[model samples]
Target: MSRTTKLATIASASAAAALALAVTATPALAWTAGNFTATLNGTMTIDAGVSASCTSSTLKGTIASDGTLSITSATVDGCGVTVTPKALPWSGKLDNGVATINGFAMDAIGCTYGGNLTGGFTGTDLPVTATFANQTVNRTSGLFCPASATITAKYDFAAS
Candidate 1:
């Protein structure tokens, strides 16, 4: 074959190969908004010195666009053995964007998540810093048990 013909043939094959590769290339996986569950930690200042820490489970919510999450309505079990954590249909945000939970407000139940979460999504645990204020209790026992108890806790948000 002529030199020009050979060069042309090689170039054509290269172009074809490039085109095939491009056509078969997979696109990047984008992070989508979805539901997730998080574990809780820290402590709940019940009253005086009577308190309960984070439980095996705490909040369930959906992933927000900003890497935070919304607090789903559910009952949190294990509150000082005398009481179960109050179930709330709370609308809260976390991870800077899990559920300080940043700007989480619950006026009807009187609770809020505290602190400022920063950085991007890296599947880290968001600690819960909440104060459940003056929760009315009717427990017949416990040193810290009061008719009205305030719960202050800091839990972690583990993405699943």
Candidate 2:
């Protein structure tokens, strides 16, 4: 073949190989926005000379693909009073089973106050149970002033 014909043949072969490689490469897995319901169950204590026990509750949210989540509601009722955030939905994100949460409102059952919470997770196994630890509960109650509770949340998902 002439030099130009040989060069053209080589270019065409290279292009075909590149196309084949691209078609065979694996695609990335994208997270989808889905409705999630998890039970937020944990412990809260006050170090008031003698440690006092406090009742705990949970909040739920919806997780989106773009790492956006929200708290739907919170329930804290054990003491003589009840405290709950008026907002039904809070927001946050989920990445690799670890959630960087935001817009969370926690209202103590006994005190007239609420706050934001941050926590880490183990992983999300649908219809299975997951555990969350190292939770930082920022309380905004005037009487209690402010407090943080080390919390562990156990979530059991309903079978899909």
Best prediction by TM-score: 2
Residue 31, candidate 1: how far off, in angstroms? 8.0
Regions of candidate 1 where Cα sits further than 4 Å from its true position: 1-32, 48-55, 73-75, 85-87, 95-148
- Model 2 residue 96 lDDT? 61
How many steric clashes between backbone atoms does each model show? 11, 6
Model 1: weakest 10-residue lDDT segment is 105-114
- Encode model 2's per-residue lDDT on 1-160: one tens digit a residue: 9999999999999999999999998765345556666653444443322333336555555656564666675565553444455655666655566555455454444443223444445544333344555455554454645454444345443222
lDDT of 1: 0.45
lDDT of 1 at 149: 38
Q: Kindly provide the TM-score of model 2 when superposed on the true structure, using C-alpha atoms.
A: 0.58
**lDDT of the candidates, in the order given:** 0.45, 0.52
Residue pairs in candidate 2 whose N, alpha carbon or C atoms collide under 3 angstroms: 69-91, 69-92, 70-90, 70-91, 71-90, 72-88
Error of 2 at 71 (Å): 2.6
Which regions of candidate 2 deviate over 4 angstroms? 1-14, 40-61, 76-87, 109-130, 144-147, 157-160
lDDT of 1 by residue, 111-150 (tens): 3222222222333233323333333333333443343434
